[model samples]
Target: MKKVIVISAHPDDEVLGAGGTILKHSAQGDQVFWLITTNITEPDGFTVEMVSERQEEIKEVEKILGIQKTYLLNYPTMKLDSRIVNEMVPRISEIFKEVEPEIIYCLNRSDAHSDHRYTFDAVMSCTKSFRYSYLKQVLLYECISETEFAPALPEKVFLPNYYVDISNFIEKKLEAMNIYASELGEHPFPRSERNIKALATYRGAIAGVEYAEAFQLIKFIDKE
Candidate 1:
């Protein structure tokens, strides 16, 4: 079975970004791993109850998604920009060595959240072909709120060039995302379930599928 990894800045991002695709991978017998770059903590103004709830949510998501394992860097939430890449890269690289994933799905570099951007940078640093020969493909998945809210600069636009049909898995993806009750909101709020399904429908139109997840192809190495 092929090994796959999904790296996210926070817990709900994997669900928001590529939950359906991950489900597809697991159903196809690919071993899937999750790398969460940040966490909510008491030091970050979150209450003890809030911190505990988020941990529970992560566990629920792992079970629902069939994640083989989860690696949490536990970096301070929303403060990734303040951290040094030097300190981040080695820890992430170690996970790369252990997982040796053939396919990686990570947050878009130009996403609105600084944490997302920084996480992408660190993950990319670990994917150099010379160092991680097992890595065959790397793709950036778009998080609904973060990606759409990014500054509308030409360079920052999320131009999706790849699509994964997720018609059968969309409901399960929504089920997994609902575990993060604190993250979702009503219709107008970007993380709402309605909006999430809408985005999938919109992307499906682009790809001629009933429902799909869109991604930006960053790298693909063919050794054959």
Candidate 2:
């Protein structure tokens, strides 16, 4: 089975971007790993108890997703920009070496959040051709609010050309998303259950499936 890694700027991003894909990989017995770069704590208005609760929720999400392992850096939230590329690249590269993932997933560079954008840049740097030799493919998935809410510029838009049919696992994706109690919202909001299904439905329509997740295939190196 293929080894896969989903890297995100925050905890819930993996769910919003690639939850169903993760489930599909796990169900097929492909090893799946999660790499979360930031953490929420007092600075984000989360008390100690809330932080602990959030951690527990992440574990539940991981368990439900059938993630073989998770690497949580717990970097300061929303401040990834302050960190230099050198600082982020090495740590991420280390994980790349350990996992030797054939498939790598991360946020698109055009995402609205600075953290997401910077994380994308760092990941691109870390997985350079000269660095991760085993890496054969890389894809970028869309985060709900952060991806959809980007500025109205052609360059900033998320244009996905790849799609994964998740008709069978949409419910599992929603169940995994719901684990993050603080992140969910009411209908009409980006992270709401209704909106999540709506987005999946919209993407499925593009791919002529009942439900699907869209992605940008950044690179697919076939050396033979």
Kindly report which residue stretches of model 2 are placed more than 4 angstroms away from their true locations once superposed. 43-45
* Model 1 agreement with the true structure over 97-213: per-residue lDDT tens digits: 999999999999899899999998899899999999999999999998899999978986888999999999999999999999878999999999999999999999999999999
CA displacement after TM-score superposition, residue 17 of candidate 2 (Å): 0.8
> All candidates' lDDT scores?
0.93, 0.90
Please give the lDDT score at residue 198 for candidate 1. Answer: 98
Would you estimate the TM-scores of all the predictions?
0.98, 0.95
Candidate 2 TM-score to native: 0.95
Clashing pairs for predicted structure model 1, backbone only: none
Which candidate has the top score in lDDT? 1
* lDDT of the structure predicted as candidate 2: 0.90
**lDDT (10s digit) by residue, model 2, range 1-224:** 99999999988899999999999999999999999888888977879998898899889988999999999878888888745555888888898899999999999888889899888988898777777888898999999999878886886677899999999999999999988868899977789999999999999999999999999998999973
Worst 10 residues of 1 by lDDT: 78-87
